[model samples]
Structure formats: C-alpha cells, structure tokens
Target: MQTILGANGQIGEELARYLHNTVTHDIRLVGRRPSAVNKTDELFSADLTDAEATDRAVAGSEIVYLTVGLPMDSAMWEERFPVMMENTIAAVRNHDAKLVFFDNTYMYPQTAAPQVEGKTPFEPRGRKAAVRARIATRLQEEMDAGRVEAVIVRAPEFYGPGKTQGLTNTTVFNRIKKGERPLVPVSADTQRSLIWTPDASRAMGLIGNTPDAYGQTWHLPIDQDRLTYREMIAIASEVTGRKIRFSTIPLAVFTLAGLFNAPAKEASELMPRYGVDNIFDTSKFAAHFPEFETTNYRDGISQLLSP
Candidate 1:
C-alpha cells in the first residue's frame, strides 16, 4: 500500500484520485482528519509533530509519500517544519519505507530568467529561502547515509482548480476576471514558470516509482515555451471570455505594502524576482516520464472557469 502523508492537500487529493482512478495502488491517506475524507477506504489520522501519533499513522506502509504540510511564512518554517520533518523522517526510517518529498525552488538565489538545476551558488536572500536550503540539505544528508530512499520533486508557482485565495485565485485570476489588468511589477514580456497541480501529482507518482529518481532533485515537467506573465494573463482572460484591463506599476507599491502588511512585507524583498523573468528547465523529467504531459494553458484556464 502507498501512504500519502498530506492527503488533504490540493495535490494530495489529486494523487489519491490518480492512484485509485488510474493506477491500481491501494492508497491509505494519513492526515489530521482522514475519516472526514469521504472518498477513501483507508483513512488514518495523526499529528506528524507527535512521535507516537506519527508512528501509528505510518506503520505497515511500504512506500511513504512525505509531502507533509507547513505554513508558507518564514517564521513557521523556522519553528514548525524541522520538528515535523524530524518525526516523519524517524518514522520512515523505522518502517524502511521509500519516501518521496515535494519541493519548491525557493532556496535557489535570485538569478536571471530560465533557471536550471545546477547554476549559481546556493545563496538565499530571505529567511524562508534559507530555511528551504536547510531542509534540502538535511534531506540530502539522510539520503546519503542510506537512512531511507528519498527523492525531491521541485515545482514552481501552482495554479489549477481548488486554489484558495492567493496569487492566482485572488490576484491574477480575480483581476483578469473583472476585466481589470493586473498590476504586474515586471515587464509584460518577462517569462514565468507555472505548475498545474494535477500534472505535479502525476510527475511525483511516476518519480516515486522510478529508481533513478531517488537521491536526486528532479524538476517537475513545466511548460515547454517560456510564456511571459502578461501572455499568461491574456490567455487566461481569453479563455474566460473576459476583456482584460491591465495596469503596470513600479516596485514602489510592493515596498509600501511591505511596511504595513505581513505578506506584502515579505513580497518587497523579492521584487527583483517578480520583475525579472523566472523559468525552470524540466526536460529531464519529461525525458523519463514520457507520459507526463502538462495541461495546455488555455485548456487549464477553461477548467478553472468551469462550473
């Protein structure tokens, strides 16, 4: 049986659906309230931060997918992730289960557009980035020591169905839906990387089953063409049959909001990144997971707009 650690998440639900609906694996979902998940036969609940509870949740599973939850803010990473990961790691080690960890490219330092896996030195600028580097290093150490077989599947900014109020649903999609152009800080021509959550799920599952994917950081398959953020917004607008009214702004607004608001406070420092074109190379994953096809941008937008 395959155990999905954060089975209540957007990607987690997709993973469960894929495993049950597509693959033959018997998925046991482990979360805070697994019984509440009406779709699954095996549901287990426990707080990964608690050792005994985590052990009980993970026992008897051969493959433990460790995509555990943690807050996005910098402070939470400092205080929460380490303890939860340690407990989960110990449990994975005890059970000798293969672990697959989800990751993002936060730790890589700010660089030019189209970032590859191996590039500039790992110099993170913010508290969250530093913490991500720490987590990656810790995972690598455990993997090197043969404590547990592991793989890190890195993804980019995610947007698909079931997204809550955040960058896409709140900022980008909302503005475009209202016929208002988003206040993009960067050039309208800056390229960006976006991950469809379902695609990420399929890629993760494929990697989990592939032995070569172990002990390596595999960039999940992303769009082949580097589309500008403006291009993305325009396509989303077109798909929704909504006329877009765009407003480009200077970096001053982000700085101003950072002074008074918390999420904005964090956003100001990363203005260069938002303004600069950011992209990732995932040809390696595509080569391996030949069936891992990403959804078309226009089609994905339509899916989100669907009732």
Candidate 2:
C-alpha cells in the first residue's frame, strides 16, 4: 500500500484523490486526523518528529510520500525541518519503502533562465532557502549511500481550489471576492512561474511509479508560458465575470509591514522572486512522463473560481 505522509495537506489530498481515482485503491493516509478521502483506509496519526511514531506510521507500506508543510517562520523551519527529515528518513530506511518527496523551488538560487533539475546551483538568498538546500543535500547523501531509494519532485509556488494560504488565495482571490484591491507582492508586469497543485500531484504520482525516477531530482509540470500578475488578474476577471482592482505591494512596504506581521516578515526575503523573472523548465519531466500534461493559467484560474 502507498502511505501519504502529511495526508491532511492540500498536495496530500490531491495525491490521494489521484491515486484513488486513477492509480491504486489501496492507499493509507498518515496524518494527525482521520482520513477524509473516499477510497483510503483508516488514517494513521503520529507526530512525525518522533522517530518511533514515524516508523510505526510507515510500517507495512511499500511507497511513502512525504508532503509535509512546515510553519512559515524561518526560525520554526530551521528548528523543525531537520528533525522531521531525520525521523522520516530513519523510518523509511527501516521499512525499505520508496520515498517520494514533494519539494519546492526555494533551494535554487536566483536565476534568469528556466530552472533545470541538475543544472541549478544551490545558492540560497535567505535563511529559509538555506534550510531547504541543507535538507536536499542530506536527502541526496542518504540516497547516494544506498540507505534509501528516493525521488525529489520540485514545483514552483502552487495554487488551486482548496489551498488558502498562498498569495493567490490570501492576497488575490479573497480581496477580489470581497471587492477590495488585490495586494500583489510584485509589479503587475513581472512574469513568473505559478503552478496548479493538482497538476503537480499528478506529476508526482507518475514519477513515483516510474522506477527510473529514483535517486534523481525532477521538476514537476508547470505552465509552458510565463504569466504576469496582470495577466492572471485579467484571467480571473474574465472567469468570474467581475472587475477586480489591484494594488502592488512594493518591497519597501513589505519591509515596513514585516515589523508587525510575521508572515510579511517571512515574505520580505522572497522579494527577489517578484522583482526577477523566475521560471522553471519541465522538459525533463515531460520527456519522462510523456502522457502527462500541464494546465495553463486560464484553465487553472477557472478551476479555482468555480464554486
């Protein structure tokens, strides 16, 4: 059976749905609560930071999918991520299960070109980025030592129907729904990579089942064309049949806000992405998973706007 760690998360739920509907029916959800998905067995709850609990949760599973989302604060991430990784790694090693880690693009340094899997260098711009880089290196070290079989599937910032903590939902969608100006983090003209969570989950599923995907890092499928915040706003306006106002939150403003707002404090370090052209190259994933397709912003926006 396939075990989904952090099963209550957005990506975890999406992966569970994909597996239940398209791939396998015998799936076990490991989370802090009961299973909410229709086709999953009973949920296994445990604090992943506890190695014994993690080992218990992962036992008897052939494949373990790690989709954990840590708190946003850099200090919290620094304190929690290593412990979780070590415990999970030990558990997966004990069970000899294949690990599919859902990773983010934060580890990659600022780049003008589309980020390729093996080509991007690890040049962290901030504390959070450094933490990500370290975790990735640790995983690679374990894989190289033949302690575990693992694959890292990375995606850019993700948004979808149910996700509410991201810029799309917290800053854009909610403001537009409430008839307020969307608090855009960057200039409306700057283009960057944004992905749909469902598409990323599907790409992860395909990669997990592919034997050759192990011991390598892969980029998940993202939009072929880069899009600006203005373009996305226009798409949302068209899809929802409502005119939306937008106010770009400048870097200086975010810095000031950071003094009182913890989330904004964490976000200030990410301003480089807003000011630069950030893109991801999924050609490697496409070549490997020929049957998979990415969802464009237009369709993705429509899906998010749907009731």
Candidate 3:
C-alpha cells in the first residue's frame, strides 16, 4: 500500500484516485482534513510537522508520496516547509518507504527554454525558492548518504478538474465559468505552459513503482505546444460555449494594490513568470517512461469544463 500525504490537494487527490483504481485498493491518505478521495482508502489526519504524528501516518506504507503544499504565505513556507520535510524524511526512513516528492521548478534560475532536469542551476531568486532548494538539497543528501531512497518529480503549473484553487482557474477559468471578465496577472500574449493534473500524478505513480527512478530528480512531461494566455481563454470559450474575455493586470498594479491586499502583495512577487516563457523539458522522463503521454490543453480543458 502507498501513503499519499496532503491527499485532499490536487496532485494528492489525483495520485490517490489513480492508485486506488489501477494499482491497489489499499491506500492511506494523510492530511488534516477528510479527503474527498475514494471512500475505500484509509484517511489518517495528522499534523505532518509533528514527527511522531508523521511516523504514525506513514507506518506500514511501502511508498510515501509527499504532495503537501503549505500555505502560500512566505512566512508559513519558511516556518513549516523545512519542518515538514525533516519529519517526513525521518518517518519515511523509519518505515523504509520509498519517498516520491512532488516538487515545482521554482529552485532553478529563470530561463527562456524549458528547464531541463539535472541541467538547471540551483540559484534561488526569492525566499520561497530558497526554502524549496534547501528541502531538495536535504533530500539529495539523504539519498547520497544511503539514509533514504527518494525521487523528486517536478511539474509546471497545473489546470484540471479539482484544481479550483490554481491560478488559472481562480483568476481566469473560474471567472469565465461564472461569466465574469477574467482578471489575469500577465499580458494576453505571454506564452506559458501547464500540465494536466492527472498526467503529472500518473507520472509520479510510474516513477514511484520504478526502482530505477529512485534517488534522482525527474521532470513531469508537459504539453510541448505552448499556448498564450489569450489562447487558453479561447479554448475555454470553445469548450464551455461561453464568450470568455480577459484583461491583464500588470505587476505594477499588483505592487500598488499589494499595500492593501495581502494576497495581491504575495502574488506580485511571482509576476516574473508572467513576463517570461516558463517551460519544463521532460526529455529525460520521456526516455525513461516511453509509454507515458501528456494530456493536451484541448482535452484537459474539456475535462475541466465538464460538469
């Protein structure tokens, strides 16, 4: 059986569903809330920061998938992320469960092309990036020292069903669904990439089961065809039969608004992504898992738009 931490979240929910339906019925979901996942799987609510609680949550699981996302606030990330990682690492080691970490590409320095796995520099540009980099480095050190077996799976932005909290959905698609003018962070012409949550979760599942994938980092395959934010709205319009239109809010606007809006202030720090083409190269993953495929935007958008 496998344990899925943060099972109520996007990737965790997808991973739990994939495993319960395809791999095994015995799955354990670890989180502080009741999971919306399959009812058959066990739900163990515990604060992962507590080492004893994490140990109990992970006991008896053959593989532990760490999909926990702390609150978006930098203070919360600074305080909780490292503690969670250390506790999780210790717990997994105690139980001898293979660790499969679902990570983001924030640690690497900004680049024009897709950031290649193992090729990107670890030059952090912000507070959140530093924390993520340190956590990844800690995991690598554990693996190098033979203390634990682990694999880090990095993914781009996510958009799919059950992803209502994501940026695209919260700021754009959800607004489109509600017949409101979408408020986007970047310009309409800016090109960016996204991954269907199921596809990313499936990649993690595949890597977790592949012994050869242990102790290394892998990038989850994404749609190679990059699409502009305007084109994304067009796809949503086509899928939902709604006349979706959007307006862009520049970083300066968010910066000024940040003085009054806490969320906006936090969001302004990430506006650099809207100014560049953020792509993730998954050639290594492709070479490792030849049969794996990425779900394109058209199909993925259709799924998200469906009732």
Per-model TM-score versus the true fold = 0.91, 0.95, 0.95
**Ranking according to TM-score, highest score first:** 2, 3, 1
Q: What is the C-alpha RMSD of each candidate to the true structure, in Å?
A: 2.2, 1.5, 1.6
Candidate with more favorable, higher TM-score: 2 or 3: 2
| TM-score of model 1 (CA atoms) | 0.91
Each model's lDDT comes to 0.74, 0.84, 0.84
lDDT per residue as tens, model 3, 1-307? 7999888787888898889887888999999984658878898999988999999999999999999887668888899999999999999999989999989877776656668888887877777888889999999899899999899999877777765356787788777766789897767877777888889898899899899999899998888888888888899888888778679988789879889998877666667777777777888988888887788888887877776
Better of 1 and 2 by TM-score: 2
Q: List the candidate numbers ranked by lDDT, top first.
A: 3, 2, 1
| Whole-structure CA lDDT of model 1 | 0.74
lDDT of 2 by residue, 153-261 (tens): 9988877777535766778766776667888886788787887888988888888988988999999998889888899899889987888778888878888888999
Error of 1 at 55 (Å): 2.0
- In the range 1-307, model 1's lDDT, one tens digit per residue, is 7888878887787777777766545778988876433355488887887988887777887777777656557787788677777877888888888888887777766666566665535677788778777877788889899887898888877777773323555566666655666766645677777787888887888788777878887888877776776787777767776666566656788788888999887756656666676767888877877876788777776777654
